[model samples]
Target: MNLLVICKASTQIGFGHLIRSRTFVENAIEGNMNLDITLCIIGDSSLKLLLKNPAITFLFYEDENQILLTKSYDAIIFDTINFNKSVFDKIRFNAKKIISLSPVFNLMPFVDICFNRTQYWAEDIEKLTLKKYGGFEYALIQRNCNRIHSIIYKYGLEKRYFNIAISMGGGDAANKTLEVIKQIKNIIEPFTFWIMLGEGYSHSFDEIVNEIRKVKKHEIILAKTNHSMWNVLSNTSLLITTSGITSYEAAYAGLPTITFYDYDNQWFLLKELVDTKLTINGGKFSDNSINNLRNILTDLYHDRSVLYDMHKRSKKQFDNEAANRIINIIKEEVFKT
Candidate 1:
């Protein structure tokens, strides 16, 4: 089966879509040995470093306008966004079946299957004729394939120390990590902050290092995005991140997260997740966000029971089989005889 995955990522756009699409491709190939996949990424070649699947073909384009679908495939999965009508039409004309991972409303009329994890699309789904799946059960979270280090750490909360992780998506274009760290400095608690910086972080490390220096009360650890995130998530008590795919990943890991967003869509998604009581809404990222973050951190610090309850509820919301379920549904729809 020939499958083409279209996704976009950059320093400005962040890498959530790219990572999600890659996860789908990885699981799809593993599920069916005969699956032939071509991943067409609308970003620079630097993004290729994120791909670990050697069995899948890779294609990169600097801009979405350059995409010309001259060849047809059995199915085309779009995890990209912000394309004009003409480009979407060309893509629709070239594919036998279409699946959408991004919440582009324009593609709903033509898509065979659409996956959205937010309830903001509930009304729209009823009006659309396509098969729509939502919630954490359909989240495309990447699996950590490395199990050799399983002996080194236990997969649960740490009672001796409070460990908080901050992972603001892959490209954190807004540099929210720096702002989040700056706010966390006000907290006088003796907790550890595990800061994970992505490969696309073009900001100054010296600034973050300098900020960490001022916070002498707490232990600060700086790490790159090279390690297995699932492992990091399993050990951390709370995650401070943008309201992106990472929040869903945290839910799957049963880690309570405090999420802030920069856009309206993310704000709505954060609200929906907060209603589930598995996540805390940190509001939009702005100049006044530091105060809110500090207060939330203080409250969670004084009362660890909130985090534990969130963890319990979060564990039941999602599972590890998200990739398999999504891929299997796509496979069934595409190959149905």
Candidate 2:
């Protein structure tokens, strides 16, 4: 089977979509060795570093149009949030079937299969075609999820400081990392902050380092790499992050999280995550958010039960084999005899 996987990643939009698409393709190939895959990412060449499959062909965003105009694929899987009707029409002309992942587009009628792990569109599920699937059972977790289990046990050993991890996605277009760090400085308690920076982070590292120096009462560790965040979250007592792939990963790792929505679409998914009772919603990113997060943090710090309850709920909700399930479903649906 010939498959075309499309997604986007950039410093402005972050890498969630690309990460999901890449993981999906990896899983798909592992499950079916005969499949020929071409991964088209709507971003620059730097984004190629995230994908490691030499067998799959990589195409930049600019070349997508020409590729679509020429060759055809057996199926096209779109993992991007940016859905354009015109582009969808173009893609349809070059593909036999269409499948969408993660955030759903309004143009669902044109899609043959859609998978949204969150309950954002639960109300519309019954009204859709038989191929539509939703809920955490279909969540596409990173491949490194299994590795974190042992790490979590290793880090579960006693520690002195309350470790809080702040990861605001790759781009952090709104620069919420600095704001979150600054507000946490107000807490007089003994806490250590781990700031996970992504490749797309365009903010001045020097500025964040200078801000870290100002905190005398607490310790701050700034992680500036594409390192496995699971390791960091394994040791972390609390997570301060945007409602993205990272939040779900933390949930699967049984780590409590305080989430903020950086984008408009994130707001809907955030609501569903809050419904799971695994995370506390910190609302949208804004000027007033600093004080709000600080207050939430202080409350969780005092009430250990709240965090522990969330931790327990997480283990009950998330499954590491969701990616395998999704891949199996795709093969069953698209490759039916």
Candidate 3:
């Protein structure tokens, strides 16, 4: 079967959508499904990372203005946040079946399947005609096929400063990484800081290195897009991440995380996750917020039981089989349709 994946990427749209789409395809291939796949990415020049894989063809469009496909695909999956009118119009008439990821309001009544995980759609979705699959059971967590590692839940509290991880998503669009790193300088914590810098991060790597110079043991990890985080996440005792798929992925890895958002779109959902006691909410990047964060960290340092409880809850929330379930949907529903 010939399949086309239409998703958003680049430093502009952020990497969550594209990462999940990539994970979906990786899972499909790992399952040994017989298929020909082409990923049509709508992003800027930073999107060349999608082309490194020979198994899938990559078509990078600078904008969402116009997209063309050579052949009508068996099924096309749309994982973008914005509903492109032109792209939708073309896919509606061209593709045999159309499916979407999350935030389904825009594509409702026009898609065959609405696979939603965050439930970001504000409209009355129950009234929509399409089949909706909602819950974290469908959240896509990208892992490198070669370095894929399972989440082994940690049973006890941390002893402080053993292994720390910092992953601020694919790009620090809001420059939150710099602020977070600067604040880390004030904290009295001691540990080996493993900072993962996204490929799209506009800031210089030297900036982070200089800030954490006081630490005796630390490493700056620069990961290309779609790179596996297993190596770093495997030994991580504590993690600081942007509220997105990584936080969800960290959950499945049995790693506790402190989640914050520098973007407005991630605020509501992240706040909800915090209120539900999923991950530690560090709030926004601010003096007051950082002070609040400092207090949280201090409390956690004194009593590691908090991290243990958070770890247990996160693993329960993230169902790692989301990608596999997506493929089954295509085989059973899309094929029959």
Q: Which stretches of candidate 1 lie over 4 Å from their true place?
A: 105-110, 122-127, 145-161, 335-337
Error of 1 at 84 (Å): 3.7
Displacement of residue 328 (Cα, Å) in model 3 is 2.2
Best of the two (2, 3) by lDDT: 2
Candidate order by decreasing lDDT: 1, 2, 3
TM-score, every prediction: 0.89, 0.88, 0.83
> For candidate 3, what is the TM-score?
0.83
- Provide the global lDDT of candidate 1 against the true structure: 0.77
Best by lDDT: 1
The model with the greater TM-score, 1 or 3, is 1
TM-score of decoy 2 = 0.88
Question: lDDT per prediction?
Answer: 0.77, 0.76, 0.68
The RMSD of every model to the true structure, in order and in angstroms, is: 3.0, 2.8, 3.7
